[model samples]
Target: MNWYVVYTKPKWEKKVAEKLTQIGIECYCPLITQVKQWSDRKKKVEMPLFNSYVFIQIEDADRNSVFEVAGIVRYLFWLGKPAVVRDEEINVIKNSLKASNIADISVSQIQVGDKIKLETGAFSNQNAIVQEVSKTHYILVLESLGCVLKIKYK
Candidate 1:
């Protein structure tokens, strides 16, 4: 068995995992509860560490089990094929998710035309290109969106 990455519909990682598990397929959805505070209140809510993505451990002999799960948009790919999830990368993400208060953050200092790299927190090792800057965030361009988006900072 090997770990495979799957792209899921927006906010559907948990749902997909639940369905997959009910059918007897092993699924892993790493999550953390964030303490979000408003002017006078605080509450904890669970959120997926990786947006729109989930990981599954599938045996090469049972790959079909993956296709049966709902909300699975597709597998991460390169050159029109499924991509393999590196053991090391999965280890890092798993270790990071185990820790709490994962620094709710969004890069806003970076402008639409500026370049930025994660300086701290969960995203520290990844690089995302900025497309637009909002009062509270930096809009990142997704390969599919062909543009940018705003993400709020902690």
Candidate 2:
């Protein structure tokens, strides 16, 4: 079985993962704990590490079974096919979260128009082209993932 990326409804990642698991599908929704502050109080909440995305391990022939659950929009596609995520890539995410020190990781200097491979974060191990860079953020085009990523720095 290969791991496939599933696009979920906004804010439905956790719920979708839960429903998938209940139906005997193996799913993973990476979550991170963040402190949220409101006018009245501050609280630590666990949020999905990847917004509107969940990873599921299933046979290719059984791919359509996922739609039985609600809140699933569609499978993320790349190059006219469902995007496949390597098991090692998934393991990297799991291990990194277990360590909980990923925030301390840093990247070296990069310039606009440079092709770089990310070593950490959600897009780790993927190649990206530097589209734009500024003092506040970096805009990267991830061809493999079919999306642009904006990374903010202080």
TM-score of each: 0.58, 0.76
> What digit string (tens of lDDT, one per residue) describes model 1 on residues 1-154?
6777788999999999898889887777878788998999999989986787787878878876677878998887655766656555566466556655444555544566655666676545544577766665555653322223345655
Off by over 4 Å in 1: 37-41, 100-154
In angstroms, give how far residue 116 of model 2 lies from its true place: 3.0
lDDT (tens digit, per residue) of candidate 2 on 82-112:
9998787678568756873344434558878
True-structure Cα RMSD, model 1: 5.8
Q: Which candidate number has the best TM-score?
A: 2
Q: Count the backbone clashes (under 3 Å) in each candidate.
A: 2, 0
Record all residue pairs in model 1 with backbone atoms less than 3 Å apart, i.e. clashing.
106-153, 139-149
